[model samples]
Target: MTKMIFLNLPVKDLATATAFYEAIGCVKNEQFSNENASSMVWSETITFQLLQHGYYQTFTTKPTADAHATSGMLIALSRDSREEVDAMVEAAARSGGQADVREPQDLGFMYLRSFADPDGHDFEPAYMDMGSVG
Candidate 1:
């Protein structure tokens, strides 16, 4: 069975990145955090590894993608409501990040907004009304 999920990101400044994630409401799990990396917890089953650029290189030979220059992937999170989605995006902006990477979108049952962290990692916070789907 899939026990847990860890999303690892290469960051330029560990301290700055750690603070950015924390500012957006993630909890840091000290047991898996250190100077080189931080384990930011989103939920009991989901954790994000914010690794220093050099430390991240130890795991791969390919050049790390410059998050600011390009989009390799998009990190998406679910919010409880449309207002929560907007609030998160606002928080990211207040925390020295870029908010509204794209125009906010609203479908009949879904609301979404994108933001970029200080390190240029992109994230999408979304709200979906399950009652509208099967």
Candidate 2:
């Protein structure tokens, strides 16, 4: 069986979070979504489970971190080309997300840019040219 990843994120509002994910090209899997959560599919093997803060707390004993003020993890997504990375960031910014949370990086073979969703979950969209790598 192929391995898959499900990233669970605590969100402030389900509707806004769902819209933001959709704007960035994720398809919502309504079969797995409800009032308290949204199952956003980024690709065949990756899905983001956006859970409302109250509902999310039930999953763990620890308090949910205020992502806007605290950093927990940074998710990096691979894009096919540099333009694709830029497009995703642009889409994110237009969809109520903050673009360029960190400075863009270019190292010839690889290019990366970062953004934060409305809830402040940081994501880095990157593209790497394998042929250009030493």
Whose TM-score is greatest here?
2
Measured by lDDT, the strongest candidate is: 2
Q: State the weakest 10-residue window (summed lDDT) of model 2.
A: 125-134
Pairs in steric clash, model 2: none
Candidate 1 per-residue lDDT, tens place, 56-84, comes to 99999999999999999999999999989
Q: After superposing candidate 1, which stretches have Cα over 4 Å from the reference?
A: none
Clash counts for all predictions: 0, 0
Indicate the residue-level lDDT of 73 in model 1.
94
What does the lDDT read for residue 22 in candidate 1? Answer: 91
Q: Kindly provide the TM-score of model 2 when superposed on the true structure, using C-alpha atoms.
A: 0.98
Model 1, residue 133: C-alpha shift (Å): 3.1
lDDT of residue 112 for candidate 1: 97
